[model samples]
Target: MSHLVLLSGWGCDARIWQSLDGHWPTGVAVSAPDWPGYGARPPLDEPGDLAALAEAMSAALPTDAVWVGWSLGGLLAGALLDHLPAPRALVMLGMGPRFCHPQGVTEAELAAFRGAFRRDADATRAHFLRWQLGGEPAPRTAHRRLLDLLGRESPAATATLATGLDWLASLDVSRVLADPPCPVWRLAGEHDPLLAPEERARADIRLAEAGHCPMLSRPEAVAATLADIAQRPEHSLLEATP
Candidate 1:
């Protein structure tokens, strides 16, 4: 049987998939482990090293599972393709090869945020939680939903959170995704403010009337879409690209 591995974005824990509760298509085994140092997970000795991070992460993730990674998690998952054995398929949701660019925040802006995080990690996490909901039709409602899903899980340690930002500021998955070891799919929310135009043009699927946090605002739709994707041949996508 095929498995489903759900990867949450930075600042969130496995609960990010709360919306999909009772909505996942039956029969697929699921795992939504937190990244090292996030939630109750222990921080790796070298949390900043992508290779080490991926290796530590691989133990909990099933190699044959279809990996669905959201936002920063998606980007990092792409990076992991080089470290872990090829997954059955990789689904990059709501992100592109890079985050610090013209379509997203600038390097300087990200640097500023990193510094801010170091000073007040809790405050920075709260502010970021609010910022990412901008593209939803009702930002306030989406924000509430996001908070509810995140629950009381403490954000990663200041240093761990800072490391995540560093990855966002520098890691680029273009080389890997250009010729991924396994089937790769890119999906984006129609109104996702954080997505790059280049990604918008190439995304294999675009969820309509959705935003950056589509899984929050459109849980049923997101779950249904994933169910559909699960039905496809493990190694192939549709003949029509975007």
Candidate 2:
């Protein structure tokens, strides 16, 4: 049985995967570790450094586990390719080779968003949450549940959020995708605002009517997809290319 590690996106903690636990297939060991400065994890010694953050995350993860990452977490997972032991598989959701794409949020927009966060973290976080849920099929319900989860978990630090934004503005894993160390699979929501239609077409699996946070809006579907992948023959699970 493959160990599955679910990695949440920016502004979210391990609690984001709460709904997925009971949904995964029995006998599959799973873990959702919070990134530094999120949940109970301490802030990184060198904030704003992707390599350093990836190293910290690698240390916490199991040596042999399939890594599934969403949004910013996807980028971090890609960055881990050279830092950690090769995983059984790597899955990316709602993110492409780069965070800033012509059809997605641009660098300038990200910088502006960072500025807004700096000016008022609370208000900016609220706005960010709402913006993310805007494309979901059930925006109201999804937003409410996400808000409730945020209330129960420790919010990411302002400095950590800034560093994440910085990474979004500059990190690109296109080269890494060109030759991944382990089998890679891409999953995306059909209505994900962060990914363009063209990009979504490249995914191995697509969830209908879902947005960036499919794990929230379509937890069962996400769980099923992961289970399916886990059951597939190793030769059939090939590395994804940009």
Candidate 3:
């Protein structure tokens, strides 16, 4: 059975992909990792941020596996793609190659949005839910589910993650596409506020039917795509080909 490891975006937990069993390939086993400080997982001591966290993850992965990452997860996946010898296939959701401009996305609007997190923690979480859904009306019920996952996280963890995002913001995936070490597929929601379609022209981008958090809004679609990638030989070939 193929091992498919799904990674969630910043401030998100593994529950994002838990509802996707119906959509995953029957033969494949799935596991999604909760980020450093999110979900019920324990927080990182001091500040051994994403890079250190990623190195630890690389050590734990199997010899052969496919990686599917969302938002900040995508950025990390790209950064650490070479760390594993496994046949890596990427499914990047609602994320760009970079988080800042030139190499990534760092629009004033987005910077301002990120800045809000440091000021009001409650409002930040609320705004995050709304932003993930592209400013659509994410009612209290929706937030309840999100909060259930996020409530366990420490604000220091969130802040540390936010600061560490600078590394992701500076990545350039254009070179990866020119000579992809693995079969990388990009998935974005048509209404995703953070990552627009135009910005994702390089990879085989699939425009799903939701917002930034398509895993929450459209789990079936994302899962089906994942299943396809897992079953296809071409995807495997790309990662292993000399």
Candidate 4:
């Protein structure tokens, strides 16, 4: 049985994976660890450093498991390519090799967010939540569900939130795509505002009528896709000559 590890994006805790948890295949074992400073997890010693953060996370992950990451989580997973004991496979959702894109969040926008966060963490978080849900088909419903999930956990620390913003402003993992440690699969929502058209085209699978956070708007579909990926023969991509 392949172990599946789900990593949530910035501003979100492990609770974000709750919907996906209930829908995973019966035999598959799933683990979703909260990132430092989120939920009950403690902040990293060096909060703003992505590499250090990835290293910390790698130390806690199972030796061999398929790593599935969403948004910022995807960037961190890619950063872990050489850090962790090789993952069985890697999957990215609603993100590409780099977070910054012509059609996605720009550096200036990120800076503005950082400023807002510095001034009022609660207001910034609330604004961010609304912005994220704006692209969903059912914005009100999606927003409510996300808020409800987040309400269960303590708000993420200000330092961690700033670190996440710093990551968005500078981190890029485009080079890692050249020779991934394992088979790599990409999933994206057809209407994800955060993903540019070119990025969406790169997806191995795309969810129709879904936005950035598909696990919330299309949990069953995401679960089925994950199950299928988990069942594929290990290194099938490596074996197949392109």
Tens digits of per-residue lDDT for model 2 on 20-125? 7578887677788988888778999888766777678876666577788899899888887877787778899888888887777877788799889889887887
Quote model 1's TM-score: 0.93
Superposition TM-score, candidate 4 onto the true structure = 0.92
> Which residue ranges in model 2 land beyond 4 Å of their true spot?
152-154, 239-242
User: Model 1, 2-84: lDDT tens per residue?
Assistant: 57788998888888888888887776667888999988889989888988987888877677677899989999999998899
Q: Per-model C-alpha lDDT, please?
A: 0.81, 0.81, 0.63, 0.81
lDDT of 3 by residue, 88-123 (tens): 576676676676554333567556766776676556
**lDDT per residue, candidate 4, 1-242, as tens digits?**
87788998988888889978668887688888988888888898888766777677875566577788999999888877766666778888888988887777776777888888889887888888778776789988998898888873436887888888778777787777777767788889998988888899878889998989988899999998888787677656344111
For model 3, the local distance difference test gives 0.63
lDDT of 4: 0.81
List TM-scores for all candidates, in order. 0.93, 0.93, 0.79, 0.92
How many residue pairs clash in model 4? 0
Q: Considering only N, C-alpha and C atoms within 3 Å, which residue pairs clash in candidate 2?
A: none
lDDT score of residue 67 within candidate 1: 87
Stretches of candidate 1 exceeding 4 Å from the true structure: 238-242
Where does candidate 2 have its weakest 10-residue lDDT segment?
233-242
Q: What C-alpha lDDT does candidate 2 achieve relative to the native structure?
A: 0.81
RMSD of each: 1.9, 1.7, 3.8, 2.1
Alpha-carbon shift of residue 158 in model 3 (angstroms): 3.5
